[model samples]
Target: MSKAADNIRFVIIMAATLFVMSLGALRLMKLQLVDGSSYLQKSLSSNTAEQVINAPRGEIADSSGEYLVSNKAGFNAVIQKAFFPTDNREINRIILKVANVLEEENVSWEDALPISENAPFEFLPDRESDIARLRKNIGVQVYGTAEECIIAMTGLYETDPQLTDREKRIIAGVRYTMYLRDFSVSNRYTFAEDITMEAVVRLKELTYELDGVDIVQEAVREVKTGDVIPHLIGTVGAISAEEYDQLKGSGYALNDTLGKGGIEKAMESTLRGKKGVRTLEIQGGAVVNDEITEEAVPGNTIKLTVDSDYQRKVQTILENHIYWLNNQTSSKAKGTEANAGALVVLDARSGALLAGATAPTYDLKDYLENYSKVANGENSPLLNRVTSGLYRPGSTFKTVTATAALNEGIISPTDVVNCQKYYTYWEGWSPECTGYHGRLNVVGALRESCNIFFYEVGRVMGIDRITEYASKYGLGEEMGLETGRGVKTGYIASPDTFEARQQVWQAGNVIQAAIGQSDTYVTPLQMADQALMIGNRGVRYQTYMVDSVYTYNMEELVSKTEPTVAAVIEDKTGHTFDKVIEGMEEAAAFKAYTYPTVKEYYTDSYLLTELPKKAAIKTGTPQMTSKSDTGSAFIGFYPADDPDIAFSGFVEKGEYSKLMIRELIEAYYNKDYHIEKLGGRTEEELAAALSDNEDTDSFDEDNEDLED
Candidate 1:
């Protein structure tokens, strides 16, 4: 070939080769400079697998370091919606298995397998006979295939008349659940009520044996003494829609649990540990590579100010009194409802709430599963009456007025006053006493709960003095206790009530105020605090349920409860609390000033005289303003002179305060015999009250006290 042609062909080939080399070099430079680290990380991720690690939950203890609530491990039967079957027969079989297991274990099926009008499916027990029986009745054969079970577990109940559409969807999505695990047992031999470690192991074994089945360790709560402290400890539930919307991206997931009531609600932030995230690479909705994007910091440990023995005593007292109250008030006022009472015991010196009890309270284990039943029941069993209930203080409030009168120099201890049957001031208003006890001193008035004596003293002191004294006595305010539940600050008459009463604040209104009427509503906690103040000679302490918060590492976030003087009656205040206390002591003994004719009632009939331990006791009966009966209440402390603990108890719609006082006294003195004494009443007397006649315009003088 010609030299020119050969040169042209060679030039074309070399030019093409050089151009390719230049392009390759530029591509190498871009990769090295622009995305080198990104590719390297991707490569490393493909080789190295990440895992999620869960932090240990914190422990819980009571005042004496006894276990009241705690955490444990258990198995959860979770069905990922993706893997679950949509068939009804499979669902029935699975439910039968669950139900059988629960029944065989002797766990109460009231909650776990509840028959709900709004739920399409029912939970199953793990027993062959039960499953076969259910299958026969439903005409659904149980092959026990994993696919069949998954289909039934995830089935949509289109035909089930009881279930709502939303409920069906929710049930379908919530395919898996961990068991309610507890460590404490009734006795060492028998299995504990809660899900056991053995069950968890069995679940793991089941997962290994079955394909498309898996198990994960999930935290479960174990209320160490749940039955004893149901009202005080409370339970947790899923966050509401509003809570979810507000907490979105605030680190709370849609499935996060929120505090529903009691200590759980009160100390939510401290008890609910900081949640962490586990990001997994999922294939067909199944996790393959699990990586803990964030670490979970377990919740802080909460130490309560509760005493187990004291709590038991309060329960015993309440149960015993239920019978006598029903008998005495059934005909007169229709008596209290079946589940209508609450009691609280507090350490008068430290504001440490020792025992809190509420009647007709549903078990915490059953509460979540049967929420509707609890909420819509005739009696609100889930209500924490001790902290949330508000009522007229009745005679217990007289302590406040007495303290005020003594401070105001309105009346001296030795000053004698005559009490007529009743007092009449203006038109259409007559404040009457139950009986006339002539020539009685302040101490005597307190013992008999005399309305006239306090009326006179209150008239001298007036409303301003009453309010001031009430404040000093820790009324009309929130007692900062650890329960975090919303406690009513308690309503006191504003300036307007007094300003409106300026012309009328003289004898009658003041008299009404002296009796705990005239715009006064208080919580049981307040009553207990006042009693404690009197028990401790007017030294008020900051009440706290939680002694401290600690980390898993045992680092204390909060210190132990410190005793604080809430208020003190100073010399300049013109009050000597000792005088009021002296009256209270005599009244507690039921022997303040006995008139010749007023001694018909035997001394043995009085509760204070028969108490095992000396207690300064007071009873109160407030007029009700609703369908509920007048509230009955009692406040006292053991070893009255120098007391270690003080308590106050109230029963809603209770007709007579004396009966409750007797029950409390008897329970303290004769522990085993108290219930028997109260149980003498028949079933007819125990029926719930019918109606309450209340007039807000008129005042009931029986409820007032000078102790505020």
Candidate 2:
């Protein structure tokens, strides 16, 4: 009631009003000047959306213009934030519906979340490796268990607090992935890829209930010969976080698919089509303005030198023989069971790979599902033996030693070496020979596979010269398979290699080395190349698989393969190659003549009795541990005078007598059997010698320690 009290209240009210006004003006300044762009973007995002249009990947065809790998139109489920329901409960329900449909169809969907779905949840044991990286990338904090991590993320997704832990975990995982992918109005998240038609139909039928869910038609890789050529063709998979980080500048999205191996990875730039963009104006969960900002460009086509027909037949031959050998009841078939094998056929003149076959094959459809099993299998079906396998040259390497000697003038075709059944050098440590081939020349030495002659000649020529000739023949060199890093170039057996393996090369090493049983190991591809060179009488051509590249319709040629000479075999004794050819001719001819008479005597007999063009072949069986057999190999070319096709084939843990490689050649040529035309019957005599004095150590050339 006093005048002093009224005046004090008035002053307090006026000061308080001024303070509140100052606070409002300061907040307005901060919004307008400091954070204007951030607010503007948020406002724009609510009314805008984008739909990505993926371009079609390239097609791959074989030499005869048949499809090896192509593309088929498929559907992927996606989520668009602009059309998505604002409620977390609605989003969770929609995802569950799609997941249920996919589960019912027995189809796979992308679920990279590390957590297990079971009660008392833990991280997937196999997925543990990816956890540290994923957590770091997504900016998630460390947790003791997967359940703890999920609970932490559930709060981030703002899912219903009353929901069960399982549902919360599922919703949190998908949201976490979307966040990692930077999913927004412009970049939609891929929920599931390569969905089946049944699943797609079910999704579309329930579209009325599924507000934000979308079915996008996508182009997925379609393998034609899925069973025959998985390693050669390879597969495409989602880009990893690391790959995305490295490739983001090159316009790759977080969910982009990339070739993981083989030709696909080799030519990714050519095969990956140009991505297109679609801009849209959305309001109230509806697309208002929509247009394609950039038109998509389909990927270019790749043409290979492979003949799928020949590849298929070759695969069948290997499969059948391996199956038969493994199950054989005959006594002679012992140690002939092939665990793994490789066959490579080359166009001798052009060096184009016609067929490259590796056994213990798998279907491409099962590649992703069975990847772990195949990778961990004892036989290693995933390994491409054409490039990855290394085996001793066995007798197949004799031609190389012969070339080196003749080139260096170390031995003459007529110069005879009296085989005394054993070769003794300085140490009295003699490498025994299977037979005493007396007074044999180079050609006859090759026919009889006389070890003493080669031992003498190779030692006389020295290791350096032999290595030089082998290098010139591309025995230990890359032939360009488009791996970017090239393929495995097998090592030559020598003192230098011996040193690398932490061992000193003694004088005893040379005797076995000379007989193709030494440390010299070669790949099947190299052997095929060597055969091509010898069959062509010393012209080595570069081998390649891809023939050409073109536009999607295969109308415009992008690039083409031109036959290039890799090397030439020059010998000091110019005409000595003819004598060497005579040796191989006699060897094959001898096998042809004695095949029938020795059919019961030996497990494997020459299947090439009649030839469209007479073949010159050299068989090699490498010796390994006393109990375990080494690889069996044969290299040759057809039409002794002029070879068009050069081939090399081998079987791991197999005996040379049972490979039946001759059958493959006969089938390739489609020739009927005729005994009279076979020029030499000497192999029958040799067949008896082979069976009577069977030396496990002499079954093949001795296998030296090889590194690739």
Candidate 3:
């Protein structure tokens, strides 16, 4: 065909093709208009949705209305994974600066970054040609401290598969394929989350000047008063895979905060707040409707039974005494330095625990910042001593023995029992005492702490009779305290003691058992609770720390724990037991249980000075198999005629019973204080008290002497 004719034919063909294409497009549009909703619903179901999780802040408070923790908006600089520095040298420098800044701000960068500057990218596939050039122009001209730079570089290297054996192993696993694919797909991951609030705020306000740094809000624990209540209030941490599986149906997500310690763990059910849900409707790549289906319900506010004033006083006393003892004790065997103990005070009438204190405690603030140090430190300071420490009751168990003696008719209050011999025999078993008392009654036996007297009584009564009596007095049983765990009901040798004697138990063992030794163990709380029962007339009540729990909106969800009576024996069962009580008063008053040669110190001269009122106490030093070990114990009630509160203290392997009791006496009974006088001191007097040059020094020489 000619050129003109061919061009005309081409135009005709193009017109025909255009018309057909238009007709098909119009027909598809018609179909879409008629049935678009069904198709659109089907298409929407396959699309990915962004899950916006609203995390509520955790609440923390002291026993009083003081807030120990509250949320403060924090700024975080999040860098998209796609924008991560590719060059080893450039990444190293960036990390080095970050570390230096963190240290300057008193923040730890170790967990966030652990790679080194000089470390090679061994994990990357071999196509990294631009890294060397990229390292030369990292933009920032400021140089960081060499130490911090090295730390940051090392931190980064250690985290990546290139430098760590473990990471390399993880990279080799097919199970990690999903993680790797997701990481690439999102092109997003966290670089650091612990930037301080101050730094975050500055960054947020000045984002225009900062490149590749975007601020995002992230959740962090608010520790108001530091680590004051770590062992009690507890903490939160990431959920474990096992926990996720167990809580699958309970709506706990993979990264949900889980209670890992203290009351948080104990009352997780009541404390865990509900999480909310959000849904979004997207059309043509634009979100049309965003709906909040549920709102987050924060964890309950727990009100503990602890009286802050008393708790604080006990803590102060303990720390002061421990400090004093540490200073006095010799380096060879410092009793106070190893003074890992607990002090518990409870209402005698009601089982409310007024104070529960433990020594060598970590600051909750330090724990949140340096959790590993608190969790696995050299002192193991995280362990709760009140509910966890169990020791032999020593002579404190005599109260149980005396009750058994009364109930079993082994002895009468008026009937005097001969305790002249150092040894007494019962059922072919004999137990020795510290010394022989010429003549003793049931009252005198307790006054002198006569082991031979109890041995004689036990022989007449037998093992079955001993445990039976002990059970009534609340021994060999859990004290029913709400500590969640570790409050053990110590062993009480059973009727099988005789049978075990045929095999494992011995006559000496029976003798020791009679005097509160052998396999018997009791917690400080149990020991104190039993003493209160005696003072309160046979009423045994359960103990609790939590008073109530409330929601964030101030709605009370649970009431304070009411005192539950665990046991109440007949009052007449041990009514005549007053004779033993009288003897106990003499023992504490005259130090009658001490050696006779120390009479002047044990008489009215010493007794009137320490406890002027009518007070009853018993001190015990149980012999240990290891000659060097001695278990010291003391139980006392002030104004013995009308007791309101009672206390029991035990020191593992204590050197002297007198020293321990002296401190115990001063803790509760010593009423004299110079606080008002000291408070009234003039500035001139305070200044005059300071040394000539000592006041100018910032560092305390005392701190230099502490054990690292």
- Report, for every candidate in turn, its global Cα lDDT versus the true structure: 0.60, 0.74, 0.56
- Candidate 3 C-alpha lDDT tens digits along 1-708: 799999999999999999999999988887698677767876665333444343554465555755555455554545433344556444444444443454556654212111222334232233232222122222212343323333333443443424443333222221122122232212333334568766666556644543334567755556666535457777766555456679768877553557777766677776677766555565654445657776666666667766554565565544443443333322222243336556666677677676666666778888877766777775457776666666777777777787777755677776666766557354564554555565888777777777777776766677666777667666767776665665667667653644655547654565567767777766777777776776666677777677666676346565556778878755565565576567667777553222221121122223422655666666676544453466556665555666656666655444333333433444444434211222234667534432133121333332221110
Q: Which stretches of candidate 3 lie over 4 Å from their true place?
A: 1-62, 68-194, 198-220, 226-229, 283-290, 322-338, 375-379, 424-431, 495-503, 553-557, 574-577, 592-613, 638-642, 655-708
If scored against the real structure, what TM-score would every candidate get? 0.67, 0.83, 0.69
Which candidate tops lDDT?
2
Could you tell me the C-alpha RMSD of candidate 3 in Å?
A: 12.0
lDDT of 2 by residue, 1-708 (tens): 899999999999999999999999899989988898877766566454566777898988888788878888878888877778878678778877777788789877766677776557778777665787656654567655666667667665667778777667667667767766777778888888878899999999999999878998878777776875678788888787788889999989886888888888888889998989898976544677889998899999999988776777777666655554454443334444578888888888899988888887777767777776767776888888887777787878888888888777888778999988777765657776656678889888788777888888887888888788888878888776665332678878889989988888977676677767767777888999999999888899998888999999698999998999999876557776787788888777653122211333324444444655667887776764432666677888887789878888887776543245566676566533221211123557434433432223322223211100
Give me the runs in candidate 2 sitting further than 4 Å from their true place: 1-51, 85-90, 115-129, 138-144, 159-169, 282-286, 376-378, 483-486, 592-605, 625-628, 657-659, 670-708
Candidate 3 residue 42 C-alpha distance from true site, Å = 12
Put down candidate 1 lDDT per residue, 1-708, tens digits, no spaces: 999999999999999999999999888878887787766665555332232333444566776667677777754443333333447545433434443443454443222211121334333434455345334433456654323333353443332435444334333322222111110111001111244455545545554333333345566666667656777677766554466678766655444566677778777767777766555564533445657788888887877777666567666566655544444321222343434777877776687887777775666656655766876776777677777787778777788888777666677778888888676545687677757778888777777778777777776777788878787777777788766556666765545556655633444556676778766777888888888888877787766787777775346666555777777756444345566666666767653232111111112344466666666777777665752446677777767878777778787765434445555444444535434323544554333221222322223343332222
Deviation from native of the Cα of residue 233 in model 3, angstroms: 2.9
The clash tally of candidate 2 reads 1
